[model samples]
Target: MPVHQVNKTIGEINERIRKGKAVVVNAEEMARIVNKEGKVKAAREVDVVTTGTFSPMCSSGLLFNIGQQPPVMKVSRMWMNNVPCHAGLAAVDCYLGATEPSEDDPLNKVHPGRFRYGGSHVIEDLLRGRAVHLRAQAYGSDCYPRRELDKDVTLADLPNAWLFNPRNCYQNYNAAVNLTSRTIYTYMGPLKPNSRNVNYATAGQLSPLFNDPYLQTIGLGTKIFMGGGIGYVLGSGTQHVAKPPRNERGIPTSPAGTLMLKGDLKQMKPRYVRAVSIVGYGCSLSMGVGIPIPVLNEEMAWFTGVSDADIQMPIKDYGYDYPNGLPRVLGHVTMEELKSGEIELNGKSTPTVPVTSYSMSLEIADELKKWIEDGKFLLTEKQEDIVSL
Candidate 1:
C-alpha cells in the first residue's frame, strides 16, 4: 500500500457526522471538486461520497419464515403465487429466487417465453402489502402429521422476510450488441439485429463498487442503502472478479466486483424494489443500491472522483460470443459516449440505451446524502476487507 497524503478514520467521520460537521457529497460533486481542487484537498474536505446504482439484478432472492400452521407440518415443497420456492431449510422457511418463473407461465411455448409473473413479482407484491397465495406440501411424520397447507398471506403475516440477494451492484459491465441478422431478446434487453442498437446496464461513475474500485472501505458489515432501506454488505458478491482488465485509471473496463447484500424486507419500499419482466428473457428484480465511501485518504478521494468519461466498458456480442462463452472483445466505449444516446461502431453511429436507470441512481445517492446529513445514517468500519487481487 502506498502512503496516503490525508488520513481520516471511519470513527472520526462518524463523529463529525454526529456533530453535523461532516462534509459529504455525491460522487458527481466529488468528481468536480477533485477536478477543480485536486484529490488531496478533496480528501481533506470531504468526509464521505455517496454512490448508487439501479439495475435489473437477476441474482436477487428473498428468505421467508412463514408462520407455522396447526399440527406443525414440515414443508418439503412450497409455492408462492405459483412460483416455486426452495423449502429445504427449516419447516416454514423458504427461499424465493427472483428469476424463478411462475409455473403457469407459457415459457417458449410460442417461440419466446413471456414470463409475466414470477418470484420478483411476488416479492414486490408482498412488500406493497398485497396478499400472496401460499401453498405447501409435506409427507406425514410422527411428530408433525400435517401433509398439506394452503393460505393467503401478506408481509405482515410473515414472521420474518429478508431480501437476501446473492449478487447486486456490479462494478462494471459490458455493453451488449447483436451481430446477427435477427433480433434477439436477452437480459440486456432486446438487441436489434446487425448491431443496430447497444444495451448496457450500469450507473457508470455513480456505481458503488466503482467509487470504491478496490473495495477499500466496503466489506463485511458495511452499512448501505438497499431497496430504499438500511442494509449491509454481507461480503463480496457471487461472480466477483478480484482482478479484471482495467484502463489506465485503474477502473475495471468489464464485469468486475459485485456485492452480496441483505436487508429487512419490511423496511424496504416498493418503488426501490421493483419487479421486471424482460420481453423474452424472463423475470428479474430491478433494485436500488447505494453505498457511502469514506474519504479516508487521498487514494479513496481519487477513486470516488472518477467521472463517467473516465470509465469505460467492454463491447460484447450477445448474438454469439456471449452465448458461446467466448472471450471476444468487440471494442470499448466510455459511459459518456453511451449516455450520449449513440456510439460509433464499424463506421456507423449505433443507438445506445441504458438498461440501468442512471437517474434513479442519482436519486438514491442524493437520498443517502440526506440521510448522512440529517444524522440518520453513519459509516461503519468493515470487520473484514473484501479480497482484492
Candidate 2:
C-alpha cells in the first residue's frame, strides 16, 4: 500500500487507541500472519480486518493480497494492561479515589509531594501518550481589597502587600488529641512555647483601632507620645489585649466558630484561593501527609485495599516556619505515629490547584495540531482523524 494510505489508516487506528476504542492485538502474532505465504491464515483467529472487497459485509477474516503487500506497520511501544498511560488519567483515579502523587507527575507540574503522599504508579503507566492534568486547587493569591475606613484613609485600588517577616516572628509546633472531642489538635507558632510569634499588641499599637461599635479599636504611638509605643490598648487605656485565641488546628476561629485563614469570615465566605504553609523542616527528620480514598469498583477496591465507603479528600498539613523563613515546617504524622495517636508539630499548607490528565492532554493535543499545521510534522492530510491507529 502507498505510505500515505498506510499512514492515514495508522492514524485512524491511533485515534481509536487514544480514545480507548481501538482493539489491542499481539503484534508478533499479527506479523506472523502478515508474513505467511499463499493460503496462509492466522494461527489464532484474531479480530477481522475491515475490507472494501467485502462490500456490505464490511469485514474480512484475512488480510487481502498480503503476499504482494509491502511492510508498513510499526510498533513503537506497548503498555501493561490496567496501567495508566498519563497523569491526567491517574488524576481521574486520584480525584475519584483521593490519591496523591497523582497530581505531582512531571506532566502535571504540581508536586503532590509538597502536599500529600502515595502514588498511582501503575495507572501512570496505562495513560502513556494520553493526556495529563494538573491538580492545582488555587490559581491566584487571595486579594484583600482594602475597604474605606475613614474619610482621611482612602481605600486604594491596589493591593496591600503583607510580607511575613520570619526573623522577627516567634515559632513552635504542638500536637494533642482531645479525648473528649475525639479529634486531633495541632498547634504551631504564636501559641507554642517557642514559636515565631506575631505580637498582636505591637501590631495593634502601630495601627490602633478607631473606637466605633462597628469597628475594633487599636493604639498608636507618636514621637512625642508615651514611650513611642504602638499597639492595641484596653478600654482601661493602660492595659493591652491579646489577639483572639486560635482554634485547635492553629487556625483563627471566626466569630461563627469556623477556622478561617483569609477572606470575609463573618459572611461565611469561601476562600477559593489562599496562601497557606504546607510543611516545615527542623533539620531533624523527614515529614509528610497523606489522604485516603475508597476504591471505586470491584477491581479498583481489590487492588487498593479500600472500599467505596472511604472519603476522597486531600490531606492538608498545617504549616510552620522559622523567624527567618529558613527552617521549614509541615503538618504531618507518620503512619506509625498516627496509628498510635502520637503527633508532632507540622507546617502550614499553601495555596494549590487540582489538576488532571485530560486538561494536560488537551494542551498537548492542541500543540501537536499546531505543530503539524506549521509543517513541524510530515502531515499530508488536513484531517487529524486520518492519522488514527
Candidate 3:
C-alpha cells in the first residue's frame, strides 16, 4: 500500500487509486482493521473508507421539465402514473414528492387507497425505462392555446429530469417501538404492539454522516453516489434539527446531519432508486447512497473507526405527538444490540428488524470502491461548510 503525506490530498489519493496502491475498506472491513490494528494504525494505513445507506427518505422528490408538451399553456394540473404532481413552477416544470398520493386517493377516510401506487413508484418506473402516462390540464393562453396534453413518457423523454432531495441520508435516526395495544405503522417500518418488535432506519455504522460526525469532511459540492448516479451535495437539508444531543463518543443520538442532493435522473438506474409506498403511509423514495471518506489524519481515522457497538440511538414512541413536544425516549441503545435480532426493552425482549439492508450497503460500498480504484471517482472539496450553513 502507498502512504500519502501527513496531510492527505484528493489528488494524491486519486493518483494512488489509479496506481492500484490505495487501500480502501467498507464499513464492515473498517471495524476489523480498527479492532486488530487500532484507529491510529488504520488511519496511517488506509487511504479511504466507503459508507452506504438505503432508506425511505420522504423529503426526496423528482423535478422535471417536459418540454415536449408543445405549445403548452400554463399547466394548472399534472398527473404522472395517476399521482398528481406540483405544477406551480412553470408551464413545463413540475415537482413530484415521493410521499404524495394521487389526488383521487383519500387521505385516510371512507376508503383506503392502500397506497397501491404513488409518485415514488412513478419515478421508479420512469427510471426503469418504462413509459408512464402523462396527463396535464392547462389554461389557454395567447401564445399557447393548447388546453390539455396527454402523452406517455419515460425519464429519457423529458428535456431535463432531476432528483432534488431536500433532505436525505440522516446522520442518525431514531429506533421506533410501539407500546400501544395495536400494531402501529411509521416511517421506521411497522412496529408490533406490546413491543413485539423494533425497527431502525439508518445503516448504522455504514452510514456516511455517522462516520463523519461533526460534518468535518462532508459538505456542499462533495461527490457522492445518489440514486445509482453521480450527484453532489446541494446543501444543508430541511428540518435538519440543530445541535442534537451527542453520546459519549460525540456521535448524535437523534436524527442529524441531513443533506440536500441533486443529480441527473437520466443517468440513474432503477436498482439504486426505487419508489415504495408504505402500507398506510403514502408514497416514498427508497434510495442507495454511497460516500467515500478520505483518511486525512488519525482523528479522521478514529471517527471512521467508530462501529455499530459504539454509536447509540434513542428509542422513540412512534405513537407520541411529534409536533408539540419531544417523543418519549425509552432508552439509548447501540446498533449492535438492536441488530442482535432482539433487544431487552423494559424487562421484555423485543425483536428488532432493520428496514435498511446491510448486505445492500456492502454492495454499494464495493461498487464505490471500484469506481475509486478505477480512477473514475475522486473526492471533492466542499463548496461551503454544512455546519456553518
Pick by lDDT: which candidate is best? 1
lDDT tens per residue, model 1, 1-389 = 78988988999999999999999999989999999999999999999999988999999999999988788989999999889999999888999999998987666455456788899999999999999999999997998799999999999999999999999989899999999999999999999999999999999889998898889899999999999999999999999999888888889988999889999999999989999999879899999999999999999999999999999999999999999999999999999999999999989999999999999999999999999999999999899988865
Give residue 314's error in model 2 in angstroms.
28
Q: Which clashing pairs does model 3 show?
A: 98-283, 99-283
Displacement of residue 226 (Cα, Å) in model 2 is 45
- Per-candidate Cα lDDT values, in order, are 0.93, 0.19, 0.82
- Cα lDDT tens digits for candidate 2, 235-307: 1111112342333322221111100011111111011111122222100100010001111122211112211
Task: Give the per-residue Cα lDDT of candidate 2 at 115.
Answer: 28
**Total backbone collisions for each predicted model:** 0, 80, 2
The most accurate candidate by TM-score is 1
Identify the superior model by lDDT, candidate 1 or candidate 2: 1
Ranking by TM-score: 1, 3, 2
Q: Which 10-residue window in model 3 sums to the lowest lDDT?
A: 105-114
lDDT of 2: 0.19
Query: What's the lDDT of the predicted structure labeled candidate 1?
Result: 0.93
Cα lDDT for residue 86, candidate 2: 24
Off by over 4 Å in 1: 106-112
The deviation in Å at residue 293 for candidate 2 is 38
RMSD of 3: 3.0
